[model samples]
Target: MLVTGVKIQGRADEAQWVTQFKVQYSNDGNSWTFVQHTNNQSDMIFDGNTDRSTISTNIFPAQVTAAYIRLVPTAWHIHISMRFEILGCKECKTPLGMKNRDIPATRIKVSSRGEYYIINSNDNTSTHHKGGSHARLDRFHYWVPDNDDINPWVQVYVGLGKIVSGIIIQGFKQHWTRHDFIKVQVNGSIFESINANLESTWTHDHPASHATLMFEKPVVTSVVRVEPNDCSETTRKLTNGNQIVILDCALRMELLGCGNIPEHGCVKPLGMETGDIQGTQIRVSYNHHQSNESRLNYRGYWGGSSPNINRWIMVYFGYVVNISGIVIQGYEVYWVELFVIEEMNNPTIGTQEYAANFDGYTPVTVLFEKLVHTTYIKVTPTACHNGYCGVRMEILGICDDNSNP
Candidate 1:
């Protein structure tokens, strides 16, 4: 179970503030056990600001399994309200974590020089992983680099840029020595470093069976790299003619941003397919807004005139999908003002509409209350904020099959 965040309400008085607490979970709702961190420590204290009318805490933990979880206050001045959000599991007491946002079957390319001893050649090709199956020890299901290699690394191209927060690395339980040092990179920039042995010493407990490297802040990028480093050659090695480095290691990386909405194969501008507005300056190209780049010239147009001008573009997904949200980025000076979204079903139905004014240069997201399934979506613009209209948009959804078609 992933604990995403916590919400505390009640009085801001010092007497009601909770300074310390314990996170305990139970299988049968009777006997509860405290959740341990890297080491065996069980005490978790409030970080940063604590005195407030409302407190919002953001914490993302690796997946856990238990029936019931509750926070027991160790130190508090007065009675207050507290709420913990457990994410990723439907059967748990909290909401589910956002499912993998990366398109399934997205190509994952690794360095050619790295040695792969026990892993299958096809094991690293897919973006999806079995959730909460960290105990599996088959090397064929993991991506293991050769111990002799100086710098072994793996890279995943998400097909487009996305916001990434954390990575889960499953360690081999049998004869493999842990990867003592590891570093993560996003878009070729260093994101975080982990000295697992050192971390265990500070926490006064042994390292976990799986290593979770979480960024203090989230990053937006299209590429992610995990590099394992052998700090000392004297470390114990796995013996099978080849030195044992990581015998059977798996990864479950988490992303937090949006991805492209329309299928690349079926994307077409309003006029391009129908030859309606032949000379318009704006046209839809699937790759234009797939990244964070804010190119002033590359944009799609929804053309119309005056206060009641209506312009729209239609997109087909090839099949039905569960749409969760949409992210829109506009030109430096022109952004769509009033717009409505409709999905194609039996007769075509309007799903949602927006009338709020937005700044042209900033990115804004519109999240649906619940996921909806549709094969096609029509985005219609009713007004423009600056009389000029163009936008770069992405639809955030997953197919019913949960795979790339």
Candidate 2:
């Protein structure tokens, strides 16, 4: 994307900020594409920021070949002299002059490699991550914007020497697709643009109106292709077609490949939080906020690592009225495994993602049938990388007011 107008009439070296700008994109969280003023082409439309100078910019569609996009600061600032504002975005627009309070234009900070970044809509990539992309099939990769006219491209891979059995492609997590469509394919086949909602007389998990593409009796394939299609499958008040906003995508396969749900593709061992260090895993609770660390009280935050081959820890404890459900807040979290123990003295076990495809700005919540009664709740990182959770969980109880557990 070409930059609109930027000028630092600050004189001499003071005009440093106008030197460069950057935009970035991300599909599965691993690889990234960055376009900036550091390029060979010079597209700065404006030379200086005057009182009534029209401000604007261009969005090269080619840059965003993934799920989400964001605007970040590309040019390095040497001193406190660099300061300016970007204007005019054909793809993403905000309030013209003065204050721009739109959601997409909100300033967000991202961590890359090992440093912090403050960015806006001018950049093309998002730093939001749910603990690394390849961590699990159940977790979600969310990218929300005010406008759906824009399509985000996402790439799915099978790594190397990986094989798997059947695969199931589901939408909205709970809704299953009869066919197991691959996220990434062998060849560079963008995606099947047309979306098809499932026909009736189908199996459960099929929405009253659902969209499913299941691969029964399927073989192992290296790379699978998944992209956004413009068409939609409008049926039975259910639009499972690919046209949805695509908050997240859940792939179910065996081995390194994706796995379908209900049908446990690969069985792997998980971890349990022994009450030794953090006490018993009676009931784990947490909450999330824009400025969370400052909003809530916590020891710290940590994410998970890998999938299939990882173990998730569960905290158990005693409480009154048993338990109802669990909630988590996060930027990008692939998937999470929930667990509960009947008693602190007894052993606690791991549970598959009772909830899958968790995404968006709101907190990620999932309800289960298992009854929980404890003072301790173990929280462990399973899929993706290792680090802090997106949202702090608040392990809601049957009763809202009292922590009478």
Candidate 3:
């Protein structure tokens, strides 16, 4: 079903008006699920009048397939009555369906090992094997517990609650056995054992190296844990005497609904320029550094001189776009003490100036009060600390071209 528009009829004062409302759908009419409304990761709303309001067509871009759709008031001025117009069609396509909705995890912890497993104890020079901290699910490096307990598990924290659809687990391949039987828990729920084995040959490059467990329906949760069952027995022996029951486990999870499209910096260096810098490595944007530090090999944009005040770098996106926020990642040596972000309608015309306060060598996000439409953004460091000032920056904005905006 396509939700064409919404007509809200209510009488209330300005303080009692219902401004924000979220659409909830239910297939069984008893249990309801929230529908994703906008790219800003918020539900749909009817803003403006306090008494009566009529929303036009295509108010909800997402396709609604529930038997019942209810408008739940989140922020309201008073009691209200709402009428939703449902337009029936063969199919309703939403922008969310056009993009991948895999949510990134903020932290991944193992029940036995914290985050990394040190291979050698004496020299402390051995490779640090990451259990669940690594982003890639297919990597051979995995987390191994001290003992092969029957309930060794790995948990992923998405930081925020999200609707998840499936979970993928990759087991270590020693001689033959792969982690076939496991238990899954969502948000401290009871552990449900599942036999997610792919009956295929155990080769170095086999496609069945990983097993995926899909839920019957989407599950709204922030934490997911995968525990090895009794069936997951390994013959490999540890340095101690106990037999290894659990091997290296890697995980990859997917969300049910479409996630917000991330705003990326301009790839083409059309009108990108920086102030006087030290060397030739001046361009610092999304392309300069990798998302994670493990894969980051290149140094970020570095200024020519030592840490000084009033150093600046400007970038033009080629066209006008609405920017919501900016992210800056600092290096280990030098970082910005105080910085100013200025939006420009033209290359030479500067608009409003926003000051950003953050710590050094850490990634910080500075959000604007409202979306600013501009073609140029200039980042000027008013103060710095440590050594030479350099940073990797990203512009979070509404793209005019793709499904992200």
Q: Which ten residues in a row have the lowest lDDT in candidate 2?
A: 261-270
Between candidates 1 and 2, the TM-score winner: 1
Q: Write the number of the candidate with greater lDDT, choosing between 2 and 3.
A: 3
* Model 2 misplaced stretches (Cα beyond 4 Å): 1-318, 331-346, 356-362, 386-391, 400-405
Which residue pairs in model 1 clash with each other? Answer: 1-64, 15-77, 15-78, 88-97, 238-244, 261-395
lDDT of 3 by residue, 69-161 (tens): 777777655555443344333222221110132323234556565233233335343234444444245544445543444456666544222
lDDT per prediction?
0.43, 0.30, 0.44
For candidate 3, the TM-score is 0.35
lDDT of 2 by residue, 1-405 (tens): 112222232224453333234455566666765643322443322222222222222223111223434444434335323343332222211111111111121122111111112243454423433211322233343222112323323333332112222223333344332342323332112122322332224343642232333322122222333433332322122242212222223222112222211111111111111112222232233222222221111333323332334333343433533343444434444233332333343344444433321332223333333224445444454432133343234443332222352
Question: What would the TM-score be for candidate 2 when compared with the true structure?
Answer: 0.26
Better of 2 and 3 by TM-score: 3
Weakest 10 consecutive residues of candidate 3 by summed lDDT: 262-271
What number of clashing residue pairs does each candidate have, in the order they appear? 6, 79, 5
Better of 1 and 2 by lDDT: 1
Q: Give the TM-score of candidate 1.
A: 0.31
Better of 1 and 3 by lDDT: 3
